[model samples]
Target: GAGVSQSPSNKVTEKGKDVELRCDPISGHTALYWYRQSLGQGLEFLIYFQGNSAPDKSGLPSDRFSAERTGGSVSTLTIQRTQQEDSAVYLCASSNGQLTNEKLFFGSGTQLSVL
Candidate 1:
């Protein structure tokens, strides 16, 4: 892909359902990250994966949130048993291998609204 790609772009679900948001990172990029941004809020780092080194899941808000990256490329973020507080934009980004200070290219994101 020319840039990171995110599926659905928008999702609205009832408060107890589960939703899966997909992300396709730029080719050859070695680091991929998932973030969440609520309405009028800053980006919240959910997880970071780099060539499988024990995925950094520190930022996951709760047990209901999970993510996985396959082949060091595309990734998916799944929110289970969604709640009203979970309504926000699920964003994904990728970089050309990590070294900190490297810019991350973001996707349009899947807007999930839990009503």
Candidate 2:
């Protein structure tokens, strides 16, 4: 894909269900990130992965939310026992991992609706 690609575009699930969102970063980018945007809110950083270093999970909201990147290219975000508060737009972005020239390319987020 020429840019970051996210799956499903939209997802609707019950309050207690689990959901998995996917992201495919631009080929060769070495950094991937996940963010959340709630209704009328700003983007909140969730997780970040760079090269082989341990992922920075500092921004994750709770233990129920987790993410993983495979082969440094594709990533998946899993939310367990979803709550109404979890309804939001899940966004993915990627960059070359060069601090001096870092620029993120974002995907069209997946809008999650928990009822």
- Candidate 2, residues 1-115: lDDT per residue as tens digits? 8999999799999999999999999999998889999999999999888853445899889999988888878889999999999999999998985662348999999999999
Q: Which residue pairs overlap in candidate 1's backbone?
A: none
Clashes per model (N, Cα, C within 3 A): 0, 0
lDDT of each: 0.88, 0.90
C-alpha positional error of residue 47 in candidate 1 after TM-score superposition, expressed in Å? 0.3
In model 2, how large is the Cα lDDT of residue 107?
Answer: 95
TM-score of 1: 0.93
Cα RMSD for candidates in order? 1.2, 1.4
TM-score of each model, paired residue for residue? 0.93, 0.94
Report the C-alpha lDDT of model 1 over 30-98, residue by residue, as the tens digit: 888889999899999899889655368999999999888888777888889999999999999888866
lDDT of 2 at 47: 85
